[model samples]
Target: MSDSEPRMIEILRILSAHDKPIGSKLIAVELREKGFNLGERAVRYHMQVLDEKGYTERKGYSGRVITELGRDKLEKGLVYDQVDFVYSKFEEMIYLTDFNYMTQKGNVVVNTSTIYDESSINILKKIIESGLSVSPYINLNEDKSEGKIEVTTLCGTTIDGILLNEGISSQPQYGGLLKIEDYKPIRFEELISYKKTSLTPLDAFSSPNRTSVLDVIETGDGIIPANFRLIPGVGRKRTLDIINKLDHIGIGGVIGISDEGRDILGIPVPEGMVGIAIVGGITPFRAVQENGEDIDIKIAEEIRNFNTLSPITTKITYHLKPVEHDIQPKISFLLSKSWNLIQQVNFDIEKRKGDIVANVSYLKRDDLDETLNIMESLYNDNPKYINPYYKVLDHPSDDDKVGIATICSLSIDGILINNGVICNPKYGGLLELTEPPLFIELISYNGSTVDPHKIFIAKDMTRITREAGSKKILASFKEIPYISRDYAVDLLDTLDKIGLSIYKISKPRELTYNAKADNYNFGIVAGSGLNSIAAVREKGIDIHVKAIEKLMPFEKMDRL
Candidate 1:
């Protein structure tokens, strides 16, 4: 074929491979990889020739892409012979696997007119996925040697292979190439405000806003290295004083505002309004009152009369409005459609703190009661919320403290009780029974007989045998099956010999006292197998529970 004809074929191959417009720099790299060694001027000349031949079209300034005719030629294998010629020339030098070399040098160029082999197409897919520019080079041969694939860019930078695997297609422009005339500045006067009028039904008795505040307060109790601020106004001071009084009356400690509060709340306070901010945990909430002047005076009086301690107080000088535009007024169908398209642009942006929520699980009724009791006891003993409740979780940790109750099942090998007693004793001797008749059984394959009569005077045994020498154990106990104190002591001793551990006996009184709302049943349930409970509480709220139980005594269910 003639020189012009081959060049035209190469141009078609380039265009067909890339979905985006190609520049001279990129085109030259492709020609170089094809062993053409063409300069920018020569590539430009070839492109002009292709444009004249209706193989490709010029877009914007200095941008050229393949025409439909050029793509057709590639898809039909019309440019195969030309590609073969180019490949034959560069077979020894081109590295198919080393895509970085092409991307860095910007030598990986596309001529909207050339056809590409499947392997070349795969390489191009990788290059695009990496969000990196490919060098303008064409290689038709594949490299079999692993190290031969040195994926370096023209800038001499090595690229991670993972970058290439995540390639995505650039969003296509609409209306036959975007132009300045296609976009117009939005007219403020003509723009109609679209309001988000939808309202979620709020519970009458429980204020959603107040509940959110309480949640924030609970989260702030943890050892977070941040300051919390109270909003300006009389009600805030009064609320705080009440809380302080509650602390005096055996409630938890209150979080105080930090220096960061000024930074968060230094916005414009509306006429006859004051802003209060609390920033201990994650995000800050703003509270505004209709009468700031009057509220401030009332708060000062409350602080002086009620709270004799270092009352939480902070002074605010400047106030500002939230930086985020209230999008509720602009959320029209048209804007939503535009937003949907805008999101497709895939622009990188930062997210705000308010955009995220803490992944904390709500406390179960029984768990909540236990927590409250712990909190109340701490407050009563100290008259201050001094002892930060170290929440106990099911997982064992050295950092966990005693009485820091977690909503976890009593392991067959019971948790250590407050009285220094390992409730679920893996091995022990006779001792004073602190609570009551302890439940014991062999849930795993193990040996070491226990004399039930010696352990307890009135023994109600639930025994199962597993494979001898197995490590699993299952046992449970309730307070109802009362036994003599001496018998309990003997039982403990026998349990120590049998290699059985103790599981805590949950009391019913613990559950009933901590009911937050009326009609909620609070109790502990433990068993010896996979246990699941998903039931609705009295207030139409759902609770999910899961526990694992095991059978003891290796020989119980042998065959079947």
Candidate 2:
């Protein structure tokens, strides 16, 4: 916060960058090179001030080495200096990247982080397997200190170097948190333009409160550090070719490549330029830090021989078998949780702004029949969210008149409960219309006081149409105990035969098309019973919905 604080921080930073003590004369030279306009005497004066503050200590006849306090001060440095430091650091790294993918030779920029805990390394391996890092290749070495492990991961900007090697000009853009679902990229949830920030986006956003890299590895739903870059349109073809080559070598960090104007996730791109999202190289280490392990992260730490690093293999195997637990207590817990869900839906409906019923049962009087027709046509066309049941209400409100109650996905949990199995509904979100549909947004049922599905619907996020494989539809994510996977799958199959819908089910302890479940629980994705109503809303029709309105017997409801 002081005028001289930035300069002092810079002096500390320069000392910290070296492993040995540096003298005032050399410090003066470096300062002048950085446009500081400071001479040796002035540098000595600042060094004396720093020494008095116990930030630096002299070693023999050598100059000064930054102390632990000095390094801490550098970390909490001024934003102006930090930003300038990061930008210059990136420029230097880009200039240093000389690795050639063709011959697989030369130096490539890498990031190194020091971890003290040995157990947290497994978390890093899992993240790499999940493809949430810049590359699967890594180098691990013992630090000078005992019990410290130095992890080297390829920096995302290494791609910039590779591009430059092939004469392709590219610019690093923003570093941000990219949302991942079903182990695939959806969109960026947060971004900080590189030019505006002092810390690398990965370093700035990799905090435990900001990233869920561990959760993403296990459950496939979380935000991870990723960066955007722009390249000339003319180099797009060559750049992709290089990327493919990198992948063949077991190195991958590319999320998605966009065409000329804008990216698929709606990130902007300049004309005649292509934008790309790449997983940050240091992302996997967030798992270590998130687990409360102390780590020192160095972005663009140094260059390494491309051949020296080894491809990351599964070093620790996770036992995916189901654990034995008292099913009765879990059943009670799930039932209580489901009741809370019902209550939340009711509360949300009460506080809802418009004439929204906020459930799956009813629609407006005018669009009820038309929406039912659309649902029928949709089922006839694709057989998803197929419910033939409907009943007209004797008393219709101005908005909630037509009653077309489909079986809410929550009913699946009820069925699982009846069979003495535990099913916990986790999140409600928009499922992208893809070959293997991935959730693009999700809000946890337990964390939120409102119905997540209702919130997404009210925000106009639904884009479901009759056309296949391109938009998002209303869906819910749930997890059943791994032990109940077989019985639950059988129950889901039975419901599917009876016109109830279940979109996907994960393996005993694996992800369901990248959507993650609990630690030992398998994930199940089901179409929201509100799909039909949401589709009608997408048609520009004003409709009210009552999601999970009530639990009516299957036989009591009649076919339309």
How displaced is residue 231 in candidate 1, in Å? Answer: 78
Per-residue lDDT for 407-498 in model 1, tens only? 11222222112212322222111111113322222110111112111111111121111123321122222222222323344444443332
Candidate 2, residues 28-135, lDDT tens digits: the string is 888877678888888888998999999999887799999998876566444334544676778777878888777778888888888888776887887777666767
Per-candidate local distance difference test:
0.27, 0.69
Tell me how candidate 1 scores on lDDT.
Answer: 0.27
Lowest summed lDDT across 10 adjacent residues in model 1 is found at 171-180
Regions of model 1 farther than 4 Å from truth: 76-94, 98-560
- TM-scores of the candidates are 0.18, 0.51
Q: How far is candidate 2 from the true structure (C-alpha RMSD, Å)?
A: 22.3
Q: What are the C-alpha RMSDs, in order, of all predicted structures?
A: 32.9, 22.3
**Residue 23 deviation, candidate 2, in Å?**
2.3
